[model samples]
Target chain A: MCQLLALSCAEPTDVSFSLTGFAARGGLTDHHVDGWGVAFYEDRACRVFVDEKPAYRSPVAEFLKSYPIKSRNVVAHIRKATQGGARVENCHPFMRELRGQQWVFAHNGDLQPLGDANEPEHGPYAPVGTTDSEAAFCFIMNRLYAHFAAQAEMHADVDDIDAVFEIIEQATRTLNPYGIFNFVLSNGTAQFAYCSTRLSYVIRHWPFSSARLVDGDLSVDFAERGTPADRTAVIATTPLTDEVWTACEPGDLLMFRSGALLRRAHVPVPDAVLATSKYALSELSAVPA
Target chain B: MCQLLALSCAEPTDVSFSLTGFAARGGLTDHHVDGWGVAFYEDRACRVFVDEKPAYRSPVAEFLKSYPIKSRNVVAHIRKATQGGARVENCHPFMRELRGQQWVFAHNGDLQPLGDANEPEHGPYAPVGTTDSEAAFCFIMNRLYAHFAAQAEMHADVDDIDAVFEIIEQATRTLNPYGIFNFVLSNGTAQFAYCSTRLSYVIRHWPFSSARLVDGDLSVDFAERGTPADRTAVIATTPLTDEVWTACEPGDLLMFRSGALLRRAHVPVPDAVLATSKYALSELSAVPA
Candidate 1:
C-alpha cells in the first residue's frame, strides 16, 4: 500500500513539519519506499516534485523539508508499488488539466482487475503511466468530463458544488467494490477525500496546541507558528501527528473547502462489496513482518 | 517577451552550466525578471521548477543551480511578462499532457490580438493563463489533436515524424502572421524550435571545447566534463556562451532529436507579417539599456 498526505487551509500554510514525518515512512520508518511525489497548488496552477527514489533519501525531499513552499492545497504520496513499476511516471500524485483547472490526485491501495477492465472504456482522459492508480484517476476524470459535457449540451451551468460532490461520491462508491481505494483529489479550490479501509484527519484552528510526530520525535507548537485566523485540515492514510485525528468510517467521502469540511456522504460498504474485494483480503494476509 | 533555453542530448545530461548563465538573465544580466521556470524530462515524466520570484534570487533556482538533476530533454524560460501578470500560473514554460506525453513550451515573443481570436475556436485544449503564449500553445495543441483525430478516423498511423513536422510547420507559419512568435517546444523525446525574430543554437560533439558564459564570468572545459558519446544541442533566444553559434533565420522551424538536427523548414517572413508585428517593433526600440 502507499501513503498519502494532504492539507487544505484558510490561509496559505507550509507543510514542512507534517511532510517530514510522512516522508519518513517512505524508507526511514515504514516500507513504502518505491517512489514519492508532492504537489503544491498556487491559485489555478500547481508545482509538483516527483522522484523515483525513496522520499527519506531523496535530496529533493530534503530540500523540500527546509524550503517551506507555502500553499493552501497540497497533496503528496509515497508509493509501495502495488500495481506499477518503480518509474517516475508511476509516482503519485498524478496531475491533469480539465476545464482549464489543474487537477491533482493521489491514491493508496490496489484496484487490480477492476481498473484494467474500466480503463480501456475511458477516453479524452487516459492514463500516461502503467499504474492502477492512474487508470482509476483517468476513469474518474473521464466520468466528470462526460457528465459536464452532457450538462453543457443542455445549456446548464454545472458549477454546483453539491452536484459535483454527488458525482464524485458516486464514482468513489463504484470503485470501492474493486479494492481498497483511499484517495485525495483537489482542483486547487477544494479537496475531496474518500476512505476505503483506513484514513484519518485533523483540523487545527485557533488556540492550536503543540503536536508531535508519530513516525518521528519531531515536534512543533502551532500556537507559536500560526496566526489566529489560520485554520488547516490535514488528511493522511495514517495519522502523522499525535493529535486528535478522527478516523473516517469506511466508505465516507469528505469534501473540504477553505479549510472547512463543507460536506460528507456516508455510503456504507455493503457486505457483498466487501466480499468481492480480493486485493484487500490479500493485503490482510500479506501484513508486513 | 521572454528568454527561452532548451537542450536535447544523445544521453541524459545535467544542465547546471548553461542554466546558470541563462538564469542570471532573470535579474543580474538582463531585465526579463518577472518570473522563471525550468523543466527536465525523465523518461515519460517531467520535473518542473517554477517561481514567480526572479530566478537570480529565488531559493528554488539556487537549489536547481546546485542540484545536478540530469535529463535528455530540458526547457527553461525567463519571463518579461508583456501580457500576463507576474503570477505562478503565468510563469513559463507551461506544461500539459498530450498523447500520453507531457509537452513543455516557452515563447519569447508576443502574438497579441491574434491569440485572442484563435483561442476561443480551439477546443479540448485551453489555456489556463491569460497570456498570449499559453493561448498559442493551446491553439497548437488543439490543432495537433484535431489532426491526429482525423488521421485516426482515416485509419492512418499518426506517428509519422514528417507529417507531424508538416502540421507543426503549418501552425508556426499561421502564428507568425500574428507577430514575432519565437518558441521552443518538446515532448521529452524531441525538441522543436521556431524563430521569427532571434534564436541561436550550438551542437557539441566528440571534439568538445572549453566554453565561457557570455552573461557571467564562468567557464567550463567540456573536454573534461563530457564523454565521446556525449552529443548535445543547446538552443537559446540569445547565444548563451562565447562560442560559434548559428543564428536561426527568420521563420525557420528546426526539429532536433537525439542531439541532431532532424529537419529544417525555411518559410521566409513576409513583409506584411513583419510590418504588422508591433511587439517586434517595440522590442527593437527597447534594446536593453
Candidate 2:
C-alpha cells in the first residue's frame, strides 16, 4: 500500500542511488503517488522535504538524483492516502522537538479513535496542521511536560533510554482505540522502529557488496566507498528489492543506535475497539471524506 | 541525541515485544527521552500514537508494551529536542492534510528557515510552530499548489511521482543553509526517505533470521512468522543491532513504495549556494522564528 525506507550505519554513508529508485515507486515507475517526503541526519541535525505532488514530476526529485546529501541516518516515505486529504499538510515524515533535540517520523496506513484535537499550548512544540498524527504528537508532548515536571521534582536523570522507550510505547497504545499501530522514530544519535502488521529490514556490514535497484536500472558497489568497519541497517514495509530483508514478528518493537540493534522484545497487545464504522454516519465517520 | 524505530512488511505483525526493548533505550535502559510516536498501517489505513513524554515513565508506554497493535507498515520516534522548546507543539512526527489524505512525518536534528507567524498563510500549508522543518513542509505544499495551478491547463494525470520528488529534493537543498535536515515521511501507502548526513538501512526477506537489540537484552526470531513469499525492508539511522546496514551516498535522494525501491539519484547541488553560507543564511533568515 505504501513504501518506507531508512538507513542506520556505524559510519556516515549516502543513499542517493537507492533512494532515487525508491522514490520513483511513489508515482514514477509505480503508482503509490499520494505524497512523499525524505529526511537525512548530520550529527544532531535533520534535513527534510515533503510534497503533495508526485515525486517523478517534482523538480525536487530530479535534484535529488544529482545531489548526494550524505548522512549516517535517514528516513523516507512515498504515500497513497486512504483516510485524510491529499494536501501537503497531510503528507508524511512529520518532525518535532523534545529535550533540545529534533525527532522524525512517517506512517503508511490509517488510524481510528484518533482523539479530538486537544492541541495544548504547551510551550514551543505545536502542530502546524490538522491530522490524527499531529494530535497524537501533541498529546505526547503534553504528557511529556507533565512527566518532566515530575522528573524535576524527583531530580532523576531520565537518561536510561530504555525507560523513555517504555513510556512512549505505552503512551501510543493508549492514544488509539482501533486498528494497527506500527511506526519508525528517531533522533540524531539513535533510532527506533516497530512492526505491527508489516515491516522488513536488511543490514550491510564488513563485507560490502554491489546492489542494483529493482525499480530503476541503477547499481552501487558498497565495496568501493564503505570500509570494513562501516555497519548499516535499512528498514521498510517491503524489501527495497535487489537486497535481502528481514521481517519483524507480531508484537515486536525494536531500537537502534550507532548502526546496531540496541534492543527488541515481544510486548502485550492493546485493547481492540469495537467496530462501529458500519453504523457511524458520514459526519460521525472516522474519516470525513 | 534521539532514537528511531520502524517496521515495513507484507502483512500485519505486532510490535510490542520488539518495541519493549527499544523503548527502554530512550531513557529507560539508555537515554533518548524527549518525546515519542508510533503508527501501524493496515492495507490503506493506519493506527498512530504519539507521546511527548519519555518512553520510560509514561503509563502510555507501559500500556503499549502490553498492547499489540499490528499493521503492515509502521514508523516511530523518541526525541531529544534540537530546535523548538520541549513542548507539545514542537514534538516530532507532525501531521496535517493536503488534497484528501492524512500524512505523517518525524525528524531528527535541527534547521532554521521556519514559517513567519506574522505573515501566516504562505501558500497552502502553514506552520503552527517555529521549527524550520514545518516551514519547509509548508513551502513544499505552496509550491505544489503553484505548480498545479501552472499546469492546470494541461491537467495531465500529472501524478508523475518523480516530479513531486524532484521538487521536494530541491526545496530540501535550498533549506539546508539553516541546519541539518534529516527526517522520515509517509502518507498511508508509500514511504519516502533521504539523507543529508546520518542514514543507513538493513533489509531481510524469505530466510529472515533472529535479530538482537543493542540497547536492550532482547531478540526476535523473525523466522517464526515469516514465509518464503514475504519480503520486507527496514531503514533507520542505525541498525537495530542484529541486522546489517547500508548507508546513503552524499546528496542522494530516494523513493520507496510497497516495500520496494523504484527510483534513485543524487540531487544536483548548486554552486551558488555551495560557495557560501550567506545564501543559506539569507534564505533561512527570511523565516520567522
For residues B1-289, could you state the per-residue lDDT of candidate 1 as single tens digits?
6889999999999789999988888888787889999999987888889999998998899888778988999999999988989998889888877656788899988775663445333445667777888888877877776787666556543346677678788888777776778899888888999988888999989878999988788899999978889999999988888888898888889999889999999866767666765546465323221
TM-score of the second chain, each candidate in turn, equals: 0.92, 0.81
Q: What level of docking quality does candidate 2 show? A: incorrect
Tens-digit lDDT track of model 2 for B229-251? 66665666556566767777545
How accurate is chain B of model 2, given as a TM-score from 0 to 1?
0.81
Candidate 1 TM-score for chain A:
0.91
Residue B203's lDDT in candidate 1: 96
> TM-scores of all models?
0.92, 0.48
Error of 2 at A16 (Å): 0.8
The pairs that clash in candidate 1 are none
**Per-candidate fnat, comma-separated:** 0.40, 0.00
For candidate 1, lDDT tens digit of each residue in A92-165? Answer: 99998766778899998777565344432344566778888988887787777667766765654334667778
**In candidate 1 chain A, where is summed lDDT lowest over 10 consecutive residues?**
A280-289
